[model samples]
Target: MTEEVNNSAPDNSRRNFIKTTALAAAGFMIVPRHVLGGKGFLAPSDRLQVAGIGVGGKGESDLTGVFSSGKSDIAFLCDVDDRRAANSVKRFPQAKYYKDYREMLDKDAKNIDAVVISTPDHNHAMQAMAAMQLGKHVYVQKPLTHDIYEARALTEAAKKYKVVTQMGNQGASGEGVRKLQDWLDAGLIGKVHTVYCWTNRPVWPQGIQWPATGGNIPPELDWDLWLGSAPYKPYVEKLVPFNWRGWWDYGTGAIGDMGCHLVEPPFRILGLDTPVSVECSVGSVYVDEFKRGYFPESCPPSSHVIMTFEKTNKTKGNLQMHWMDGGIKPERPEELLPNESFGDNGTLFIGTKGKMLCDTYGANPRLLPLTKNASDRTRPKAKRVPGDVEGHYTQWAEAAIAGYGKIELSSPFEIAGPLTETLLIANLAIRGIDVQRPNANGKGVSYPGRDMKLLWDKQNLRVTNFDEVNQFVKREYRQGWSLGV
Candidate 1:
């Protein structure tokens, strides 16, 4: 299914360039993807040509899902780390390889039909934006972008660019969410008023200071490219491969990593929106016997964030959502027997009548009471996504090849964007949990923002109560990297 790359200037270069320039000057028009083809639109039989950025780890899985769909070909692979890309390269030897996505997109945009991004949180926006501007369909990893502004921008861009888009919260395609919604539809749980989502994440380091000494850079890794959009920092050993999830510059803490998976069920089931108010209490770490570790650069070891959302159609009143991470689990419901599992990563819904819960990826959904099993009358009302979670890739590929509005997706940017915004907002509250304040008594320190309830102005993307933490709303990109571009 691989197509030969257009090494020379194609006849459509001028037209393509004109379209792209116009998009940059005034966002983009909502032109259909099939507009390139005459009449009957794009054929459903056509294969989607996919290019992958960050083609390692989760990125590899995403590409594999696309290939496994039997309706797409993996045409290009890009990654910052050759070591990490080795498996995908071996798997898709016919696919052309590149180390920098910017280079790949610039040289091969015409050859690519869609782009999949699974890089660290910081790089998601820039790479996805580049692809979208080129009129390429995009499937970005969960928590969509590193910051709130990026999330909003990408959300709008999907509409403006008129391209098919999906965020890699594959859980949205799972039957678990459908089952949960069925229970809600059946009134089994009544009206959900409160929700709790938790995960035993941050198996990596957090609440710790950066290493005093930088480590040797891995030969296969492009350190600078890997730090795209994030401020430069010398290489450190454990930070590579995965531990980056714990740091602020690269990761969005544990919540950013798992919240998209765990919190999504509640967000979808409850139809939640931006939180009006948020407050947080985080677990601290101590570097010495004197004081608690205040590694402002790292996320807290654990946290409990409480956000209140205005009532939605699915909710009865103001919705209270609690997020817990770092092995923090909520009190087990009385219906759950001592032997029953509460799950390592899960979401729970508290309704006016009873409560229901599920594991990560919205799996293993169950109602309250140790014996409350699904009866004949408790059939699924919502249709389950075909092929379950992995279908997320095929869904996007087909929609891209078939044009906009062709197929319904589980976690499209429209849905994933708001979900990501909520999670990032929660991060703002977490980041502010211990911001140091200027104390007149300079003997030691003071946390004026400690335990403060942050009032989020979604339209402005700021913490109204604590202004200092608002800086995180849309962080400044490092020199040479721009999300707008």
Candidate 2:
């Protein structure tokens, strides 16, 4: 499958009109606010009207978080599966419901001031691009996009459309990241050199084969629509609602599932960009006494990937980042005592001066050896989010109300895009391991992508040495679906 990147300029008449109208509304509000009510009063119309796509599970929680901020209203709810959307539908009965997000945006564009997307990985780019084309502020869930190309596109689209965009890596807004940043800035952990981020995910099934028999389609589910942008396939049992994470077509494997939450802090603290090179080795499942199971369609049970990044302002030299998943972890630092937990899922930053580690979402950060740490280490230096992690939702809503470029978001597309690309690049190495080709002698197969460091051409978005793996960079969408870049 091949994809052609669209480079034609997008029409901006609607965006310009919206900006003009907003300016006029601001002019009207400037004079009436003092006379209409006392200080700090907000009329109902002032509340941001938010539309939610994929309003189930994480989607439901995302809308709930925005609503709890008291600065937004759930104006519309959309989901492909009615059964999955029941709770959200009951909670926001007043909001319009739709099985198709395209129909929702088409009809209610004017009513919606923003869009919150918590869809499966494959659909994120298309859904977000559609909303942004209509000038809607978007808050996309973590990992941002399913592919490296899509992540880069959305990052650029956020700027092109002048939308207030935030990726749902809520940990970026937590006190722990700020604390970690402060330590780095204050030279507590001098110049971070090597970092390790690990997760025990695939808590769902992985390293398995696709079910041979297609399951009966549920009455409330639209299997075709659910496969948006992905190649059409029969409804596989248990792939919906969750288990899609392990599949190559619908999900981006464990790294895509948890890397955004795990790798985000080090990405931010170090201000890293695209990596220079990446290499990985994955664990194989056994099918018999001698042969190993080969299921290229799914992610491996475990993987240890190393990515090398050029020196950023925070580092003295090139940095190496190791990512391990499926219950894998790096060597425990000697300074850490035996009793203290190294955490099942966390990030460890090794610096010239000292070492610091934090749990998932950058929570519970601490320097090595609890006994030697000084009380002054926790001194406040970095700014804190109003409500820490929960504040991520409100910050985006308030920023949208304040208009583009008004307020800073912790995981805005500017930061999230590259961070996402970093993880996806690691995945490239993982997937490359499975790339099979006929041998030069035409008798057996050769896995050229294995046991070698894949050089990256960041500007071109391809693996320089291993061309076979580039196919995973930008996927070919199904008919009628386009990123429309």
Candidate 3:
């Protein structure tokens, strides 16, 4: 229960007045050529004024799905929990609420434009890198960042604040994950190798029990901005309005709560990058009675993570991916169909030619051994792919007013920041035995230690194993709340 690492020092005159008013609003920004020629387009009487920042539980279902997808207009609502920002200001009575999202981005930086953060995950890379350095346009949710150098510094501040980003792994804009990425890009599962993907999640909050050591800190909640950048613990409603997803200094457990929606459709129809190694095997162990939570009654209220992707002669080969959560379920391949039921949240893949499954969030995905190899007939029917047309909160309100139109955003932080740095490196391999010690599965347990299996040069994000886990790839802020990279 002691994480705290902000290293402060930002606010360089509010970061150069949000970089000179987002470079003078990107020099008069007008690239909305058509999409009804912007200026509040997505029509329902052209809305989109939005500003939300963690507006209570699933940010109040992503602000009622972007104001019922009439395409936005919530105005402002932030939250460090004043009764869940007064229940989103009683369903946005012309909202203007704020409990400090840096004082509602210093008093509505010219009427928000777009924000919607859905916080907690250690204040998601500092409120989506201060709303993409104030040009706004962000959606952010999923395991976007709670380390791994703030998921590559919020994917390079959303490509240097050009903004318009999305992450709330809303089953990657379903339609069964675009027909499971067009059945793994029309190969109908040929290359894939081994991919599993489970999730029962803590089923509705899991087993890592910890919360009983005093109380009294709920005068409507603030507790230091809900323990803002986390660390100075004490106030505890079992760690906030929704048991902070199993907690590892503030959520990222249960493999960062369903590893970006069960490891995003086999990491985007098998394009998986970075993972020449990673190993985890847990179950049985207890007595860390959860501090800043993240199970440890010896470990394994449910666990099994075995990642292994290696194929860098320019990818498209060696893959392994297995990951199972609480109700653990993998090992059902006799070509499936025993009345087929890879349910309770899903993903399967396992191909050389047949298998692929789906569920939990990606809804109905299929493609099992419907028949082909040495056929008894019946396999020719692969077409269905159009999912989330104007869905995932109107695809982030039509990419915040006409930007990413052909609507493809599902966990886009260049792929949810390396799938949240490989599920927060499995919570640093389940707290790498509190940083060295327990190995033969004893203290907290550990693995992936040939110096955390090196190899991740993603261009130059570093770690060919630079002296072992390169200080676990970033973290040491906590002064005025650093995070500038």
Candidate 4:
């Protein structure tokens, strides 16, 4: 029900900048693998120079992981909030710092061989796109982007710009996903038809109204820049550092936060694509005993979303994928032992021949029925990243050094983007559940979009029968912000 339109960036100049930079970077500035052949031939100075945007929290950890790989130099850091960047700045004392990412990219484009982005969902597409347009390889934290259009655009841009790209769903690099694949391939699970992924997230507040009054902006934060692409609004307590996940403008809610981590396994195992249909049922909060409140601005407290994808060669029939979040979970599989624990964050796959379960990041995968044959069926046939999950960062850093397509990436945009689109498409149904219309007799409000299966036309990116929810497919950015698609 809310829309913001501000498309005022100078088109010609931006396109020219991207084109010129991409042509100049037809080859990587980072030393290729051949240049690092032997111990004596490669100097410490030959490491790829990586600049990090939004270097705090996960960003700090991502940068550390890259540097720890022993293949990259942490050359620059950028974040709008000085407070959040403090830990990363101290950690990388030699790295130059900038408050604005655009400033950082503008000044250091030539010096940086690659960039890592761990900003909030809203800023992800723009920052990553800008880095790619400048012909730098990129590593972005997952859910890829806030919207489906952004995901698709970033996917295509990675190929067009000829840059190495990785989304931070480190789970994609985990052995668990590989094990599940091996089990499936070994004919242990037959063919996967249904998947249930659940999480106890939105640990932050949701299903509430925005604050009616604005508070004083914090000294350490740049409010304007933090609201990049999102409509400008006055500051509110506890929105920064975290908690932005609940708001539609800044985040894609729980699914966005954890879908990349949990849903990724199924996407890879099943070889799924954009969902053909999505349906949802959400938990509601009551203002009083008699009244239930609908807060469209925020995500619901709990949701159970089901998405269907047409049959692929790997799937036996149409695939039915279920996503539950905000503490909701699927029924315990009967095959699971009564005494065994169902992980708070985990995935369950019900295949025609058998079943399998796993924990977050696709770790701890085990065949169901609490039987010995589950673990006995398969040995790994797939390649693994050296450090397993932690290797996700180094994989990208090494790939950046190796140049595009020289090395394989586990969660490159081509894969992660489509996976992200599935999650966001499910979100369309989640958000649509709250869509309001004039009640009969125009007395008040009614949820016209609830409890109905929503059909998706992937070709056009629309809700074929439900026009109201199509607005979310691609959001209108604030003035001066665009995906530059």
Which runs in model 4 stand beyond 4 Å of their true positions?
A: 1-45, 373-377
What CA RMSD would candidate 1 show?
9.9
What lDDT is reached at residue 346 by model 1?
89
lDDT of 2 by residue, 49-153 (tens): 889999999999999999999999898999999998999999998999999999998887767778999999999999999999888899999879999999999
For all predictions, the C-alpha RMSD in Å is 9.9, 11.7, 22.6, 13.3
Q: What is the Cα-based TM-score of model 1? A: 0.90
Ranking by TM-score: 2, 1, 4, 3
Cα error, residue 444 of model 3, in Å, equals: 30
TM-score winner between 1 and 4, please give it. 1
Kindly list the per-residue Cα lDDT of model 1 for residues 1-485, writing each as its tens digit: 12334544464687799888988655323444345453223444457878989888988998899899988889899999999999999999999999999899889776788888989899999999998887888999987999999999999999988889999988899999999999898888788898999998889989888999999998899999999889998998889889998899999999899989988888887788889998888997977888777788999999999999998878888999999998888888888778988888889999999988888899888888747774526877798888898887778877887788778888889999999999999998888877787678777668866768889888887888788898898899999999874
Per-residue lDDT of candidate 4, residues 1-485 (tens digit): 12222343467568889999987665444555334432112223468888999999999999999999999989999999999999999999999999998988888676778899999998999999998897888999988999988988999999998899999999899888998888888888788889999999989989999988878888999999999999988899889989999999999989999999999998898888889999999998898899888789999999999999889766789999999998999999998778998999999999889988999999998877767554494678978888999999889988887777889999999999999999899999999988888977989877877968999988788899888899998999999987776
Locate the minimum summed-lDDT window of 10 residues in model 3: 32-41
What total of clashing residue pairs does each candidate reach?
A: 0, 0, 16, 0
| Per-model TM against the reference | 0.90, 0.91, 0.33, 0.90
Candidate 3's clash total is: 16
Q: Compare candidates 2 and 3 on TM-score and give the better one.
A: 2
State each model's CA lDDT, in order.
0.86, 0.90, 0.68, 0.88
